[model samples]
Target chain A: MNKDYLNSDIKFNKEVFKTPENYFDNVKEQIYAKTIENKDGQMQSRVALWTIVKPQLSLVASFAIIFFIALFVIDKTKEITPILGTADTSSYIYTIEEGFLKTNFIDFIDPSDSSNYREEIPQDQLAEYIKDNIDIITIALLD
Target chain B: MTDRDIIDGLMNNGNRDHLFRLIVDKFSERLYWHVRKMVVYHEDANDILQNTFIKAWRSLDSFRGESGLYTWLYRIATNESLTFLKRDKIKTFFSFTDSYKNVEDRLNADPYFSGDETQKLLYKAILSLPPKQRAVFKMRYFDDMKYEEISEVLNTSVGALKASYHHAYQKIQKIIEDSV
Candidate 1:
């Protein structure tokens, strides 16, 4: 019985495979090159995806900007008004003229004079006196 | 990257350099032999080796980490080698010119191939077995893989693989006896 196996004459695979000279470096570089190529592709898609999405997002952002502008304009329009400012003593005084107390409302300006608000008139009567003066001034302006 | 991470990343189109390097640096020569054992030529092994890597890259996404990455890769390479062998067998079986004749011509030129009678008888005996049986024999004998490892790589049972190897060895012994 001839037990033919790795004949002593068989001349291959007697040892482990070895890397030839310069082959290991080539393998490493190839690995690196493939990696860089994959990363560059990922960066490109990120840029591309951002470009496609930004314009749509910008339209909604523009709408928010306009709403803030409208709010600021409405606030500014309510801010500056002669009636909302301090009263003008030159245009108003506690004048008893022919049973009439005259005081201007729309054109009132602030006064630095302490004589303008005297303790002689109660606050309840002050409204009636100022309203009567306003009517008299309105007639003068009309005339 | 850890080998698993690198393999996962590569499969998912993420950075694969570390894992792939490990793969090439570690398995290239071994894979070359695996392919070479079947095709029996340097150029053929080179072709199959590149293809196995490319196939691994393309299919990495489906890998579920169910098996060790090395075994998974070995599985792919082994299957590729067997597929090549089967294709060659079909072509040789059909064409009267015979594919082994071309292999014989190439092997005759190989300075490493021995021309002794016992080696010739052993070679012929290996040829007489079916492709799968020959594969089991080679994986078991030449690669010296355990039955469990062979099963992991071949997707065959250790019992079945053991049986196939036994039958192949017996056939070789019988063939050698007849030739003598």
Candidate 2:
């Protein structure tokens, strides 16, 4: 039966709300006790948690560091190593021997004496000539 | 005691509990009303206010005094109230209940809510607003907080808060007119 109920304008008045007697005091005391208890509990839990987790974390970190170092070492080894297989290496050696025979042996024979020297030497004959002229022990040692 | 005195006392490990009692003395009532206006239930407001203080105690190390002590506490209270409302809304939704009706019933039943019919209807209108807008309106209209202070507490731009308050005012005015 308030007049404001009929009026269009309902003024904002905060005094209408109420609280229980001594609620603030009761709450203050409650908050103080609760916070103190909570602080002690929290400190204990933090210390316990760190004690449980510290070693595990350290172990994980150690493993991670070791794993990275292993990866780095393997990568460097790959860089220094040649990629050729054994068969491919022998073929490469034959190619160099053929070039050496063509340039040093065949060309060194007097070209004016065409009958004594041929345009190309067979690989077997070249191997025999190198074996007879170059000491096999000295060649192996140099290699 | 001044805020600086309280902060200095709290900074020391030995005086922290005693100083915190002073803080509770200073802010509990003001913060309780701020929360009560939002949630409209004394019990809920009580819970939120306690939570605000507890949170402040836990995070004391982080309070660098960059803002006023009351401003910081207000921010915490506002956040707790909003979170409670959102959580309560979800609970009401899942329970297949109308949150508005529930508040209205509680408002009528609560001995603490001494408002007459007109005040009750005004609260209903206020409740109809979105949570943030409700906060803005209550802080501005009831608490008479400045727009700048509200901005700090709500972390909103002053212009936006002004606009929001205007919209909230118009909406409540319309609701009252229609009821009449």
Candidate 3:
């Protein structure tokens, strides 16, 4: 092979190849669009700290509210005294009049009388009574 | 704008996009031809060019003033072309096919190839060299790039690149003469 012959005979042209019309015009736009799309996707997929903490904060706030309401209701119930005023029983015919019962109950119950005997209900009967009276009011007060 | 002006604009957060567009507009054609000569297809060249610019955009922040912007861009474009060729070669290997034959077929059948028989022969002869040698030959012979500039793009010593180009030239001459 003759290097001189090859060099003289062959001519290399860079302009031999062609591209589609307006190819370069759109390349920058295409790349820019791709970058923007990637950025948008990243933003959409990102999890904000507030998004996660907001639900947890709301849950804690709800629990605190419930606790404070329960405390208020319990305090109100404790402040209520049992009704012990005398009652007019002339218009009401009953097996036990309120005034008579109150007067007798006060006389019968002596806190200092240790020798007084009182019958206690059986454990099973007391358990049955507790189960039957278990309602929202009892649950709320207990909570 | 000058390379320094472009670099300064890129450093400024406000002017980055406009300056990058300027960079792309300025270098795209040169880089495209450089890649197209190696890849031998318009679409493949376009892909390589896009990859080159994307890589540049991603790493623009780390670009210090150590090398000229043109040299940096050329380096990126060259690496992308080589990587594309490597991937293509791997694919061809896995498929039990000849990589050079595939490129030859593309070169012959490509609609955009308007070269005469002699030019076609020259291209075939050039492609016959190893990939790195082909790049060196194309840069020196066709691009008319100096050995120093080619060295910067390839990250190789100028002496080694000159030797590679000389060898590539001899090989291309022999191939062309044999084909003739």
Tens digit of per-residue lDDT, candidate 3, span A15-76? 68888778788876665554433433111122344554566678889999999999999887
Error of 2 at B46 (Å): 0.4
* Per-candidate interface DockQ score: 0.02, 0.21, 0.13
lDDT of 1 at B62: 76
For model 1 the TM-score comes to 0.53
**lDDT (tens digit, per residue) of candidate 3 on B1-180:** 898888776666546567777888888888888899987778788878877877777777788757778888889889988877665654555555676686679789989888887788787777667778888988888778899988877889999998999898888777777777
Q: In candidate 1, what are the lDDT values of residues B1-180, reduced to their tens digit?
A: 366775676657764545666666777666767766655545555556656666665565677778777677777777877776676665554445655466556555655444455555555566667778887887777777788887877778889999999999888776666656
In order of listing, the candidates' clash counts read: 5, 0, 0
Native contacts retained, all candidates in order: 0.05, 0.57, 0.38
Q: What is the lDDT of residue A10 in candidate 3?
A: 62
Query: Tens digits of per-residue lDDT for model 2 on B17-117?
Result: 67777778898988988899998888888888888888888887788777778888999999999987766655555555686788788888998888878
* Candidate 2 interface RMSD value: 8.9
Which residue ranges in model 2 land beyond 4 Å of their true spot?
A1-9, A40-143, B12-14
- Candidate 1 is graded, for docking, as incorrect
**Candidate 1 lDDT for residue B36:** 61
lDDT of each: 0.62, 0.78, 0.73
**Residue B121 of model 3: what lDDT?**
75
Q: Write the per-residue lDDT of candidate 2 for residues A75-139, one digit (tens) a residue.
A: 98776565543556667678887784334464467767758456466778787677766786477
